[model samples]
Target chain A: MKVKVGMMSFAHLHADSYAHCLLNNPRAEFVGIADHDLRRAQQKAEQHGVQAFDSYESLLASDVQAVIICSENVKHAPLAQMAAAAGKHILCEKPLMTRLEDGQAMLTAARGAGVQLFTAFPCRFSPAFQQLRAMVQAGEIGELLAMRGTNRGVNPGGWFNDPELAGGGAMMDHTVHVADLMRLLTGQEIVEVYAETNNLMYHGNFDDVAMLTLTFEQGIFATLDSSWSRPRTFPTWGDVTLTVYGTRGVIEMDMFAQYLRHYDDRAGRIRQVFWGDNIDALMIDEFLRAVAGEPATTLATGEDGYKAAAVAIAGYESIRRGEPVKV
Target chain B: MPYFSGNGLSDTCPRRAGNLSSVVNLLTEDAMVKVGIVGLGTMGRQHAEAYRQMPDVQLSVVYDRHMDRAEAFAQEFGATVAHDLSEFLKGCEIVDICTPTYRHTEYALAAIQAGKAVVCEKPLARTLQECEQIVEAVHRHNALLMPAHVLRFFPEYRTAHQLVKAGALGTVAAVRMRRGGDFPRTKSDWYADFEKSGGIIMDLIIHDLDWVRWTLGEVERVYAKSLTFRHLEHLDYTLVTLRLRSGTIAHIEGTWCDPGGFRVSFEICGDAGMLEYDSQQMVALRVARRAEAGQAGGVEVPESPAVENPYYRELRHFIDCYRAGQSPEITVEDGMEAVRLTLAAIESARTGKVVKF
Candidate 1:
C-alpha cells in the first residue's frame, strides 16, 4: 500500500517542491493539501492535481497517514502539534521552530501520540554530500579538525525577511542547513556558537549576511558563512558548499555544481541546466520508508531538527549577548 | 568602443562623472602637465608606465633611496632621475607618492609645501596621526590631494556602483569582498614588517575597505579575527565584519597566503537584485532580476565591457581633476576614513570585541 502523504501549508516556498515529490514518488500517494489561505492552497493543489482543504482540521480528518508541515517558521510547532495529535507522521521544514521551547513541544506531542516525526533537511540526500559523508565516516580525512561551509543564496523575501513570521533574518534562514549538516556528518553535537550578523547588502530591516562559528563536542570546529550575497547573474540561486579539513586530508563539496551552464542571448541571461539526481524525491522516499517499518540511515529525526534549531536559537542569543553561547 | 582623444571628450565619456567641458577647455589651455614619482618600487613603476602612456601628462622625474632603480626606471620611461626627495619635487607640478606607507607623509608634505597636487597610494599613511598630518598639510598649503583607491576605476566595480546609485539593484543589503595575494616581495620586504606596512589588513584589504565605504557609507562598528603565519613564515590572513550606519553589513577577507597570483572578488546583494564578480571565475559579472509579481526571471550573466588598466584610469582621473581644478574622486578624508576603519578592525581582532566607530 502506498503511504498517504499530504502537505499542510504552502507558506514556505518548498511546499510545491515537496508536493511534486509526493506526486512523483510511486511509493507515496499524494493525499491532499490544506492551508490557512484556502484559495492559495487550491491554486497550488490544482497545479499538482490534488485535493485542497480549506481548514487544517478538515485535512487531518481525512485519510492522511503522514503530513508535511511547510508553514512559516513560527507556525511550525502549532501545525506539527495538530498533525501529531491526529496520529499522522510528520515531515517539518528546516527550522523545526524558531523557539527551542516550541520545538520541544512539537517533539513531545509527536512522541506522546506515538507518531514518527521527520525534519526536511534534503541536503543530506545530495550525492556529493553523501559521498563526502561516507568518506568522512570511513576516516578518509582522519579525525576532523575544522570545516568551513557557505550557504549563500538570493534573498527569498516574504515571511523570510519578517522577524515576526520567520523569527530571524539571514542567520535564522541559513544557519540550520549547515548546522544540521555538520552535526550529522561529524556525529557530534555543537557545544558552542558565536555569530556575527548584519544587514549590509540591502540595508533592509533584517540581517542578510552572517558568519557563525560553531564548536562541536570532541573539539571539532566549523565556520559557516550564510549570506544572501549571490547576484542575479549567478547561474543558480547559490551554493551549499563545505570544505572539511581533517588530520590526514581535506574534502571539498559543492552540492549544486552538477549543472550545465545555459546561456540564452534572447533572454539576456544564463540559467543552470541541472543534471543531478532529484534530492527532493530521494528525501521523500526516505520519509515514506521510515513511515514503514524500515528506516534510512540519513533519516533526520525530530530530535535532529531540535538539536540544529537549538544551535541556531543559541546563535541568536549569542548575537544578543555579544559573546559565545553554549548550545 | 568609442575611443575619445585626450583633449576631445564627449559628455558620455566614462572618464569623467559630470560635464568635462571645463576640463576640455582647461586641457586646451594648459601644457602637458609634468608629474614626478617618488619610490621606484612596483607601484612606482606602474604609475610611471601609466603616466608614460598618457598624452596629457609627462613623467618628468623618478626617485628612490636606491638611485640605481630610479635611474633604471627613468631610462625605460624617458624620465630623469632625482637623487633626493626635494630634487624629485623640483621638476614637476604634480607628485605621485608611490613610496612605502611610512614615507607617504614626508613626500606628501614636501609636495604640498611646494604647492603641487599630490596623489598618494592608499591607506593615506600607516597611522591615524600620519594620515592627519598629510590632511593638515593639504589644508595648510591649499593643495589638491588624491588617494589612489583604484578599485573605483575598475569597470566591474564602477558598473556595480553606478547601478546602485541609479537604483537598479534597489537598496544594498549585504556585501562580501575578498582580496588575496602571495606575500609581497619588495626590496626591503617592507610589507612583512607590521610597523611599516601595517600588514595585510591595512596594506592589502584597505583597497576593499575603501571600495565598500565608497559604495555604501560609513562603517558603524567592526568585529574581526585573523591568522598570522609569523610563526611559520610571513603569511597573514584576516576576516573583518563591518556594520554600516545604513544598516548594511559587509564581510571583508584578506590574505597574503596565496602561493602565487593575486585575486579579488565581490558579491553585493540588494532587495531587488544582486551584483557579483569573481576574478577566479574569469567570467563577466552576473546580475539577476528579482522574481516578482508572478514573473519568472533567472540570472543574467552578461559579458562585461573590456576593462581598462585601472592604474592608468586612476592616474588619468587624478590628472584630469587636477587640470579641471577639481578635487579627486577619492578625497584625502576618504583615505583617512579607510585607514581609521582598517585600524579599528586591527584593534577588534586584538581586543576580542567589536569596535564602534
Candidate 2:
C-alpha cells in the first residue's frame, strides 16, 4: 500500500520541493496541500496539480497516512500536535520549534499517538557523509578527537529574519543540520556548548553569523560554523562540509563538491554547475520508507529534532552569558 | 602611468615588477633616497631586492651580526656592507628593520632617534609594551614609522577592501582567513622560540588579524586553541575566533606545518554578497551576487591583474609617503591594534577563556 502524504502548510520555503518529492516518489501518493494562508495553499496546489484544503485540521482528518509540516517555525508545535492527535506520521522541517518545552510536547504527543515523527536533516543522506560515517565506523581514523563542520548559506530573508516567525536567524536556521550530524557521527550527546553570534551582515536585530563549539560527553569536541554568510550571487547556497580529525588521520568531506565550474560574462563570475545526486530526494525516500513501516536507518526522529533544537537554544544562552553552557 | 595617490592602485601598479630594471625609468641617482636594511634573513633579502627595484629609492647598505652573511647579501645587491648597526643608520635616511622579532624594538628605536624614517616588519615587536614604546618614540622624535603589514598592499586584498567600502558586498557578516607555511628555518632558529617570535599567532597570523581589522572593524574579543608539535619545536597550529565591534566574527587559521609550502586564502561574507580569494586561484576575487531570493547565484571572478609584489608595493607606499610628508596606509596605531589582538589570542590559548578587548 502506498503511503498517502499531505503537506500541512506552504509557509516554509521547502514546501514546494517536498510537494514535488511526494508526487514523484513511487511509494508515496500526494494527497493535497493545506495552509491557513489559503492563497499560498491554492497557489502551491495549482502548481503541483494537487488538491487544496483551507485548513490543516481538515487535511489531517482526511485519508492521509503522513503529513509534512512545513509551517512557520512558531506554528510547528501546534500543527504537529494536531497531526499527532489525528494519528498521522510527521516529517517536520528543522529547528522544529522555538522552545524546548514545545518540541518535547510535540514528541510526547507523537509517542502517545503511536506515530513516527521524522525531523528534516537531509545532510545525513549525502553520499559523502555516508562514506565518512563508514570510515569512522571502520576506524579509518582512530579515536575521533575533534570534528569541524560548517553549514554556511545565503540569508533567506522575510520570515527568516523575523524572530517571531522563524525562531532565530542564522543560529536557528543553520545550526540544527550540523548539530544533528555531529550527534549522529559521534553517537555522543553534546554536554556543553559555547557560541559567538552576531549581526555583522544586516546589522538588523537578527544574527547572521554564528560559531558554535560543542563538547560531547564522550570527550569529543566539535566546532560548527553555522552562518548565512554566502551572497545571493553565490553559485549555489553555501556548503555543508565536515572535517573529522582523529588521532590516526583526518578525513575531510565537502557535500556539494560534484560540480563543474561555469563562467560567462553575462554572470561575469564563476558558478558551480551541480550535477550531483539529489540529496533531498534521497532523504525523502528514506523518510517514506520509515513511514511505510520499512526499517530505515537514516530517519531523524522527533527526539533527534528535540536534542538538536535544545542544543541551539543552549547556544543562545551561552552567547548571552559569554561562556560555555551545559546542554 | 602616473601613480594615483589613493586606493586605485589597480590602475597604475604594474602586475609584474620581477624584472624591475626593465619596467622603471630611474630618477637621477643623487636625487634618490638612501635606504638601510638591518638584517640579512629571508625577509631582509626580499626587502633589499624590492628596494633595488625602486627608481627613486637607493639600496644603500646591508647589515647583519653575522659578517659573512651581510657581506654576501651586500655583494649580491651591489650595496655597501655596514659592519655595525650605527654604521648602517649613519648614511641612510630610511631604515628597514628585518631583524628577528625580539630585535625589532632595539633597531627601530635607534633608527627613530637618528631622525630616520623606519619600516619595521610585522608583529611590530614581541609584546604590546614594546609596540607602545616604539609608538611613543615615533611621536617624540617626529619620525615616520610604517609597519610592513604587506597584505594591505596585496592586490586581491586591496580589491576586497575597496568593494567592501563601495558597498559591493553589503555589510560584512564574517571573515575566514587562512595562512600557513613550512616552519621558518632561520639562521638562529629564533622562530622556533615562542618567546622571541611569539609563535605562529604572533609572527604569522598577525598579518591576518591586521587585515581583518582593516576589512571588518575593531575586534572586541578573542578565543583561541592551538597545537604545538612537541612543545612547539618546529611546528605549531592555531585557530582563533575574533568578534569585531561591528558584530563581525572572524576565524583566523595559522600554521607552521612542514607540508604545505605556503598558502593564503580569505572569504569575506556580507549581507548582500560575498568576496572570496584563494592564493591558489588564478583569478583571486570571486564576488558573488547579493544575498536575496533563493541562494546566492552566479559569481563574478574579477580579473586578477598582475601587480607588483606586495612587498614592493608596501615599500613604495612608505617611500612615497615619506617623500610627500604624508602618513602611510598602515599607521603605528594599526600595528598596535594587530599586536593587541595577537597578544589576546595567545592569552586566550593559554587560559582557555575568551579574552575581551
* Top of the candidates by TM-score: 2
TM-scores for all predictions: 0.77, 0.84
Model 2 stretches with alpha carbons more than 4 Å out: A38-63, A135-148, A186-189, A198-204, A213-223, A243-252, A260-273, B1-32, B56-58, B65-68, B80-93, B181-190, B228-235, B255-261, B283-307, B324-326
- lDDT (tens digit, per residue) of candidate 1 on B1-357: 112222223222244333434554555425779999988787887788677656567788888899778778889988999877778789889999888998898888889999999999987999999899989988888889998988777777777777777788787777778777556776687887888888889988898898888889888888766654232245566777787888777778776654434567887777677777877677555456674796422211122444336777778878878877877768999989999998998887676567887
lDDT of 2 by residue, B1-357 (tens): 134336546343345556667444555666688999997887897788778767677888988899999888888988899977788889689999998889999999999999999999997988899999999999999889999998787777888887888888777778888786556676688888989988889988898999888877888989876654236346566778888888778888776652434567888887777778777565445555666776421211122444556777788888888887888888998988898998999987777688997
Question: Interface RMSD in Å per candidate, to 1 decimal?
Answer: 4.3, 2.7
Cα misplacement distance, residue A80 of candidate 1 (Å):
4.1
When candidate 1 is compared with the true two-chain complex, its DockQ is 0.32
lDDT of 1 by residue, A1-327 (tens): 999988999999888888888988889999888999999889988999989898999999999899999999999999999999999999999899889889989999999999999999999888999899999999987766667788988779898999999989888888888888999899899998878777756567887777776777876656688887776566788789987765555676889888998888988999998899999889999999988767667868999999988887887898898776889
lDDT of candidate model 2 versus the reference = 0.83
Q: DockQ of all candidates, in order?
A: 0.32, 0.47
Compared with the true structure, model 1 gives a TM-score of 0.77
Highest DockQ among the candidates is held by which one?
2
